[model samples]
Target chain A: MNAPATERFVVPIGPQHPALKEPGHFEFTVEGETVVDATVRLGYAHRGIEKGAEGRNWTQTLYLIERICGICSHIHSTAYAVGVEQLAEVEVPARAQAIREIICELERVHSHLLWLGVAAHDAGFDTLFMYTWRDRETVMDILETMSGNRVHYSANVLGGVKFDLTDESAVAILKGVEFLEERTHHYRKVVSEDAFFLQRTRGVGTMTHAEALALGVVGPTARASGVARDVRLDAPYVAYADFPARIQLLTAGDLEARFLARLDELLDSFRLIRVLVAGLPAGELTAKRMPRKLKPGEVISRVEAPRGELFYYIRSTGGEQPDRVKVRTPTLCNMGSVITQTIGHNLADVPMILVGIDPCFSCNDRAVTVRRAGDDNGRAWAWADLRRYGIDYYRRIRN
Target chain B: MDTITTQSPPRWRTMLDRLRNWSLANSPWLVHYNSGSCNGCDIEILATLTPRYDLERLGVKLQGSPRHADVLVCTGPVTRQSADRLRRIYDQMPEPKFVVAVGACSISGGAFRGCYNILGGVDEVIPVDVYVPGCAPRPEAIIHGVAVLLKKLQPDRAEEIDRLLVEAGAVVGEEEGIDEPNAELLGAR
Candidate 1:
């Protein structure tokens, strides 16, 4: 549908579009070259993960949760393990905590580099995309050598970590980190100094501090906008308490700032890895004992995922299986800002803006659809009405 | 109409068919779609294109549209919502196209086996020509899978490639069990 004179046209990208690495649907209403309005529809990658978690036992459920997002699989399982361990009242060894922190930081290096390549590809900077990804292989090799798997390392067990670092693997990791550090210096220079790349990023999709705070953005996206919110610094779960992460902040709040925020975070990650490795705690890899059944309790675990804040809520009814499990990934927090910022921009810049948030469809596709009773034509439901309807519906099911 | 039905095909028609097959076998373009993956396999598939794996050295390129692609590379199990869209993409591809189902989830719903919304595997929604196994397979494994598909595209060299794979310990058939019981259809072959 289009207006007669104004001629507003909607361009739908998704389900199988090429610019996106995952499946998502976005409708951008444009007037000539400028985008007027934008709306997003998710759930293309929804596999009923939350509902599936309810059916499996605690340990089996951990494996399923690790599949939630392959890019951030380590952080997903870390959040879950932290929460589950809290509910079980089991104390993991200090060495295990240190190893977990090291892997988390390594995963961040890989994830951020992966995002840099994908964002560069979206901006038509294929050379940067190829070079970044090529260098990303170094971190991937280190992960594979440590955990035996590249993408889903399964590094974290419920009580502790599965693999331990020896002097040899430690040396390998240091070597890889050193090489990556050099590359990071070059990439940071390119992101800030290269005039053509800056044109695509600088001052584009600028989200101010107030707008970032209002939208509830998280991670590097918010950090770029000058929001000082990081779960690792705030909560300090696992070994983060000992080896703290330095927060990278910028106030420009533009695409370039987001790139710089992640790059600067990489430098911090390299330093953190060095400190964690040098001061490797000497202890057992796992706890002495972890009960098969967890105690009846609810716990919330928050961790700084490579993207932003990753939250896991666990409620166990003193059984082998959890009663309810909920996850809120960083992409969900940053998605709103994308829609708000896309307006008043050119259609060609929409992909770059979307990639700016490094959106993950599979990680944030937990949703449900509801319609008003006896309504023939579908209409949007207000929040209050929807909440009332949910209460009544669940009550009816209980009865 | 009677003359067209009764006459044999022209020589140019046969030559053109051979030419099309040669090009399709030489440079097999791929279009990747995520039905409901966890993003593990999708990233690995992208990694194959990078310099480390260098899948393009095999003359394989990832296309942005299905119409221009010769192979449909799918990841993850088929979710109910994405089933229709997956089918539409497959329908849009040109004829003689093949589907490569990457990741254990897409091959048999892997970890998400009994999820309510999952339809179980890429083969449930579309025919899969090759299945690459792993929670997320390594990029080298993905390249091997592509080499296998390329061998299948050229039947004349299938035996030579099968011998090479066997010598390299990547046995082509009967070892890595898949649901598709056709013994000859297994492995990159």
Candidate 2:
């Protein structure tokens, strides 16, 4: 794969790289064990979502935007719904808003647990991965019980929510939340106390508090670095104003700190869910008569997604369809930190550092042709030469 | 060992079909690729592998390489950039390989249709064996779609399917000696 043992070489990790579940290519140039430079090629998952929204009407676009991420579908829809609701000047019923908040918190629990499982698996801790994913069923079940769909719950409509929390559903949710709270504590202890797990995470991929702010990282990644800028706490939209969210802060600023921050939030969600269910308001599930066409205006809607802050830039041209809808997902914003963090790291740690941002390449990819890497600086070989090289290498290894 | 009964007829040849069907149905190694989905169907596919749905118990292993996989499980609509890649992956899989297109978007470009960059569903790029329909289908729907594909793989079961399709005028073939798979049998244009 390389020439001289002493010479620096470029290793291209794919649009189909084995390490990545989603399609994203990364080029890493290494000088022996240390990585000297890195560049990422996206757009493998770009389905022209923002462009598609322009053709869809306001009501239909609600379902379209929600599919941006299966893991964070609720937050995306909530962001879009609230923005559209505001543009229409329709005030949502209090009960409907509370239902939306509870679902959002449940989504947080699901997303964090999902991220934890994948992160642990990336670190070669399959045991933790299996355990966390197994426990995630509790939340998935609760969500299914509530909304009749697991992944894209479609809980948020234009003006309000789709369903209410019945007494029976509330009781079931309380039990599920209680079970998850205990399991989350166990996972937190495992990540912190397990010596081998600690070895991989404790000081690995440490980002300075200032660097995190400079890079404009958000959500648990930012909170882990001691920056508390949660959209729910800061703006308190919808039910958040009635039920304020407590910011989960950590200052370790390492991979472990990121883990701890999300875990703390998972526990906080449990508390929030209980509060939401116990004090369930009485009103209609959806607001009456939301206007089909929004008033001519442009507004920015922000929501604290499970991953981070989801920003929706919506422009209504006094028509049924939006003039333009721009979605700036947190993964796209946090990608800067991931690329920058890859430098000065060991080649083995590249995957670990890159996934620390918990990237959803599908959410971030907007079609752009990545420049072919320029550092292949070796002699070009013909097809015959490459075949010969493969034959000789395998032959030598066999001998 | 159980004794073979000679009274009814020779029954050993039937085990050949049964054994093959059992092995094929039991262990379907899946190679998942997101052509251009929102990650909604992708995560649900992964969830199918997790304990809640446990697609593994049915012998579904998520493989990393297309060369090693028995089925190519794809999610989302096919974007222009990914259409070529999707075709290449489909070509790379071994013979008898199946393609399971999950999500409503992948089936007929449900949401992402008419987007300039999107080529629409997986079928636009490659032949799909099964279509699991949902904005993003649940894990149960995914498993059921796979089961439908696996069921058709059996030689005896395939004849039954072909007969049904022939009766419905979906596939233009007779039940006897019709080995070739017609395009219409793929379902849902």
Tens-place lDDT digits, model 2, residues A297-380: 999999998879889889998999998888888998788898788788888887877778888887788632234688555664
List where candidate 1 sits over 4 angstroms from the true fold.
Answer: A1-5, A368-399, B1-16, B158-189
If you assessed candidate 2 against the hidden native complex, which CAPRI class would it receive?
A: medium
Across B85-105, the per-residue lDDT of candidate 2 in tens digits comes to 888888888765778999988
Query: What DockQ number belongs to candidate 1?
Result: 0.79
Can you give the DockQ of every candidate in the order shown?
0.79, 0.51
Q: Write the per-residue lDDT of candidate 1 for residues B61-178, one digit (tens) a residue.
A: 9979999998999999999879999999999998778889999999999999898779999999888878888889887667668767877667786766555544443444547632
Q: C-alpha displacement of A205 in model 1, angstroms?
A: 0.5
Model 2 misplaced stretches (Cα beyond 4 Å): A1-6, A367-399, B1-26, B155-189
